[model samples]
Target: MTEATVAIALGTRPEIIKLSPVIRECERRDINYELIHTGQHYSDNLDQVFFDQLELPDPDHHLQVGSKSHGKQTGEMIAGIEDILLDVEPEVLLVQGDTNSVLAGAIAASKLDVALGHVEAGLRSFDREMPEETNRVLTDHVGDYLFAPTETSADYLRDEGIDDKRIHVTGNTVVDAVGRHRELAAEKSSVLDDLGVAVGEFALLTAHRAENVDERDRFAELLTGVARAASSLDLDVVYPIHPRAESRLNEFDLDVPDRIHLVEPQEYLDFLELERTARLIFTDSGGVQEEACILGVPCVTLRENTERPETVDVGANRLVGTDPQTIHDGALAMTNSTTDWENPFGDGTASEQIMATLRQTHSVRTIQ
Candidate 1:
């Protein structure tokens, strides 16, 4: 196979974390690739800190397309990516997860007849109301290669009429990321000590979904539940507030309980260490759910449905809606339960498998 020029498009902290291993693999093999940042998450905490901590190469191109309404944001991203795709003409375009960036990259690549690879593909929350669901579904359909994270995700693609030959079950890259950074996180992060919390003594909490935080009532219920659960367990809760959620809390005039400490977002290493050491986790973020499960920390999801059903199936997580009572009960149960449940996401070689498959399947082209 000849060498291929690849382009990876990503935005947001989770995408960077999950795609780090793949980027490193490209570097190690001396592959010609360009990293493009959509600026979907342009904040220092949400974006720049991750690259510094994960040691990823600086993005070759940054669109600086900050947050906007879904239609506008996605359209802008598609236009921005199309221009780059036209200029670079990479043999393949790779995108991960179900963000607007992923959807835009898929659309641009498909229109240009570039072979598109969708990592973390075929995850379905089955809730059309969720924007992420729509993005994942569309990207999966348009993709030339679907790198599913599990058998369940692969089955979802097959059911959607995607060719089996294009589907590869390469496990979640979260596993690869966690495996690579856990030890480094423990050594370097002092979030636990800084917060004055002992290992296995605090409950980590985070809620950032628009459905949960944009609505006053729902946000109130989630906050109440977190407080109730913390009070019941006699454990302090540490919440790294996402900017959106923080603004909503102020807009709604909702007050968090004293036991729930609201802090700014931590760097990747600090956040990873927090997840690894926490006694329990309550979150509305899918990436956090995966991280908690990978770290053997019991998780109570603040949403009614989850795309990562493997976490629930393996008994590592429970889905409790934003209802106060349900959230409280779910957290209580998870806190009291054992974390002996197996991790369904495979061992840390997912990046290796992804690169191998890409190399074998695509007609390699040079970087020039």
Candidate 2:
């Protein structure tokens, strides 16, 4: 244990949740690691609360880079990150999932000769139209170690000419987070009671994909479909409203109905509690797809395709494109389906597995 182990970077809420387990791993193993936050999200709900709730150390460094066009935002982060790399110069750079920040971090590290380990690597929708697909592919290509969340995602990497030895099928970290938080959620959460929804009496719906949110008709249609679907079941539809989606909701003059409860997005612990008790879930998010699967709740994905094909492969989720009939029918079907899914993601030890790989790859550890 001569050299300090790694430098890890993340910018969004998902990154925080996924990386929390690994940070714990670093502490347990006495591995020295630096956490860098890029300030990409810049929302109290999305970023700040995640840090405080997860007890993630105040980032060793923060860029405070506000939002910008995709290219400029990413380029600015790349330059700033490269400067930081020049300073800490740790043995490995650990990054999470597909986002501009992760892509920028990978680019900076690769150009500077830093070894990169991509957590939540190898996921693909195979649609270049999706920004995430590009981010995942490019990041995996540069990563020295790749942690795949499912067999399907691993196969995707192998097909793309990734080094077979570099990829490991460690399960999704959302599942890890779910397992780590369930009891605490049950013990601490009152979302269900506050919403006045009995156990297993509601469908949790969350949709804020940029593709759907930007088009007024598309946005109106999505809410209309949810209103129709949830109303049909006589089930409560609890939407922890996303701010971006809220703006769109207003711009489209879409009045969120009484049945469709629009509320502030809950923090990690509360959201997981809602997921645990939810009868079903509808989302345009990759992370929610994985979370519902881990909790054994049926999911209707509003997106056309999912990167986590394991959910579809296991019959735990159904993809319904933004068409109103398709979305309505998918949600209705999910209400009746009683399928139980064994989590494809590993057994809540992805962080430990990631650290084990880091140790093997970099050969170093020190607390400070």
Candidate 3:
């Protein structure tokens, strides 16, 4: 607490969203920190929207690495991060979630002998085929402080040979951000008005997994399923299309149906508001699934499986897969199902819990 002593490393939108709550926590508690953005996603659309929507301070450094093969991109980030880290010389380098950016930053810090803190440390899809799974596992091994988002995540670390003393069940900061921003969502979102959606009268739809978008027919099938579900229920559906999904729609000649309002990508605040009013939501995003569960909206996951089984266990979500009939039936069942259930991700004190871990791990360590 003697000086601002943490550096946050991020690149993409998910890292931005998950880390924003941690940055805000530092600010609130008078913790000094520097934010470093590795430009793995350099598009202003991909990265800037999050900074603007979250109202984060301009990053102290941006690598501007842009797009490349994952190995090349991550290597570029490691070199750039090492340079900046050498200059700022913080007590701990903080990386969030499981992106190549986080992986690169952790590698940079480990080589430099800097203490490392990882936010959202223990999520796993058990699919090493995913670039993210590798990132998550590697980061956990090197982190001096690991802030796991759930007890499930903490248990994952324990099973993986992580010392229990180094891992803390801090809950997910997504819940912290959602809890903090719910009122702003109510005040700023016009999504409900634009779609003529009354309270509890609509479903929110989103689907952009690589499997759904990278394949032409699969992408069309996703939209088609949502369209069918919206029509069957006679409910207005608001879908804020992701760019990947939009590009595939054009490639596949998919139609945006009358009942399905294909809106622009929403900011974090508006997206939370949309989740709040949605009768049921459909998506393949793990973060959105967690958000919807925490916001008291029943969610139909548009994928074969979810990494966040805790939400399903708590009765807040169901995996509906890509079949149109399944999407429709799942949405209908969610609409009819009870939403009054406990949020297993804790009561939004993740930031405080994380700070406690950092305090215990940090001392007069040698500066980088």
The prediction achieving the highest lDDT against the true structure is 1
Ranking by TM-score: 1, 2, 3
Better of 2 and 3 by TM-score: 2
Each prediction's number of clashing residue pairs: 2, 1, 1
What does the lDDT read for residue 207 in candidate 3? Answer: 80
- For candidate 2, the 10 contiguous residues with the lowest summed lDDT are 1-10
Report the Cα lDDT for residue 184, model 1: 99
Provide the lDDT at 239 for model 3: 86
lDDT, candidate 1, 196-310, per-residue tens: 9999999999899999999999899898888898899999999999889999999999988888999988899999999999889999999999999999999999998999999
TM-scores of the models, in the given order?
A: 0.97, 0.96, 0.92
Candidate 3: segments with Cα more than 4 A from true spot: 1-4, 364-368
| Cand. 3 TM to true fold | 0.92
Model 2 regions lying over 4 Å from their true place: 1-4
